[model samples]
Target: MLDLLEADRAFVAENEAQILDLEAQITARQRWIDLLRDAQRAAKQRLSSYKYPVLTLPNEILGEIFMHFLPPYPDPPPLVGNLSPICLTHVCRRWRDVACKTPSLWRAIELHPSVHRLSNLGETLSLIAKWSARSGHSPLSIRMECRRQFDPISIFTSLIPHRARWEHLNLNFGSGSYIQTLDIDRPMPLLRSLTLTVWDAVGTPLPLLEVPLLRTVVINDQGSPSLVLPWSQLTSLTLRRTHPGACLSILREASQLLECRLHLWSQRTPLGGGAVVLPRLESLVFERDSEVCREFFESLVTPALRRLELPEAFLRPHDVETLKAYISKSGCTLQSLRVTALASLIQQILYRMAFRSIPTITFCE
Candidate 1:
């Protein structure tokens, strides 16, 4: 052991001078690298200090320009593309900071749970939370659509706190959705427009949508008789896949409607002589496979009706006569008639009926 220790000491003694020289070289090179890094950082800073024309603009002016970068309202900007808000930050740090502070640029949120969730809901929720925060106090336009096997309960819960900020809410849930009861028990003060297209809605009706400022609504559902809303305040309504009897019931309460469109098949004809007088109705369009039957046709009294569109398949036996009677009873001077195609039969009928001044017929394909 003593001989081995002596041999190791002799080897260390010989290499000590070489090890010290290598350490000195390494320390000097490190010092040089540190100096080079400092110089590079200073040079970059000086280069950045050079005046660029756009960066000279004030923060407010930059904000205005950023706003122009966005598409029109109701059309959301993309999230990650070159034209997206995310790209605005890639230009420079100043633009990044400015965009981060501009709440309006990020106020629109559209979440497709089915498309995004690949068994990672926590990540999706994190993204939504961050995006919603950037909106700050601006009113929100939220669209939540789930088409497949995904439960959106956590996502909905994340948005519950921002209910008052909701200006427009669109929800289209699909198969295996966990939304059994959508409780809108909270009053949405800023909500103006709502579009709901629930395919397999829960048996229980959605909670009464207590929104005072709501003026326009589009529901693409079978029927919502139990759905409570301020029906009297609606000015424009468009419904798809609604029953005829249910349509009359809604129109009865929606006397304030100016423009209304219904696209659906006939379920139950309101054969009972019931009429719904829409005093303020101006534009009425019954498009697609809308069954404009006798009972439904005779029930409308739209004196202010200016533009009327009938469906392509709306040629029952007495449909034309019922339309004439409806026009006569309403006393509305027909200005324009919009139909899918102007058949010769309809033209001959119009001529034979001696319709008052064959009002400039227009075929709207």
Candidate 2:
């Protein structure tokens, strides 16, 4: 044991010199690394004094980036100093200039009637006009939602001047806004999309039924007898929490619809027995499944139907058969079908339908 201990000590002494040499080399390399790190940080600091790489990007690229920052279509974007596109301006003078000159950046104007005080109506109008002017000749997308009534004279006057440029408009009128009536006298030659959620619609409907280029319409109401849309021209339509009968009535006129979404509340009366043939309809989305929904699908003669979605609803085997028969009668090439049910029995049963075009089927509970 004593001899073994002596041998271990000798081995340790033999390696001590080599260990010191390795430690010295490590220290030297660490010093070089520290020096390089300091130099790299200094270079970075020097480069920071110049414009950023993104800032050097061309104004057109910046404009495209700014557009991406906005919410996608059918959604209203915020017009604030802190939020995107708007905040891009407050970054620096160059950014402000580019953003102001980029007409597309200023195209989507959202008016939050709650933000502006009633006393500052004139100032608000002036500000809106200034904002509108920045858009130049570009088409406009305007969204307005307010709880209180501002002087319509000032508000509409500011907005009306830009009517010729209006391509998309979204209006959400809340309670006590005293905005019961809406009228757009000018022809919307460029209008393509419109969404309206008007409560207490008092006077006549908006005078926008005859827009030549209007293609998309989305409305949420029980049924707006006052409002009339150019249904034949629409390619996409959405109606939520509305009567199924009313929807069928609209579908009767919306023969050109390519996509339709009906989120109806339970109906007391069945749809007036009629068929509406939508030859171009490709996609249909229903919020729930019921007798009314079944009947609605039965009424549709959509030769182009490809996608059908019925979320959170019960569909029995007979109903699935009815659906399969409808598809067969329409001669549509079904690509996708989505239905939600707690039980898997119906999904299995639906597989028995010998559809000519086997679709990618989904069952969600």
Question: Tens-digit lDDT track for model 1 on 1-365?
Answer: 99999999999988998899999999999999999999999999999888888979998899889989988766666544566677788888999999989998888777775544345677667767877888899999888876434447767778888988989887766621344444565789999988777665455554545788999888865325335667799999988888777777778999999999987557763455467889889899887567655557667899988888785456456556666777889988777776654466666456346455546556544
lDDT (CA) per prediction:
0.74, 0.73
Candidate 2 Cα errors over 4 Å, as ranges: 1-57, 73-76, 115-123, 149-156, 175-181, 289-293, 311-317, 345-356
Model 1: lowest-lDDT 10 consecutive positions: 174-183
The prediction achieving the highest TM-score against the true structure is: 1
- RMSD values, in order shown: 11.0, 11.6
Worst 10 residues of 2 by lDDT: 174-183
Off by over 4 Å in 1: 1-50, 79-83, 114-119, 147-150, 175-179, 223-226, 268-270, 315-321, 341-361
Tell me each candidate's TM-score. 0.77, 0.75
| Whole-structure CA lDDT of model 2 | 0.73
- What tens-digit string does per-residue lDDT give for candidate 2 at 48-148? 88877898899899888878877875464666545646677788998899888987777878787565333466666776876788889988888877544
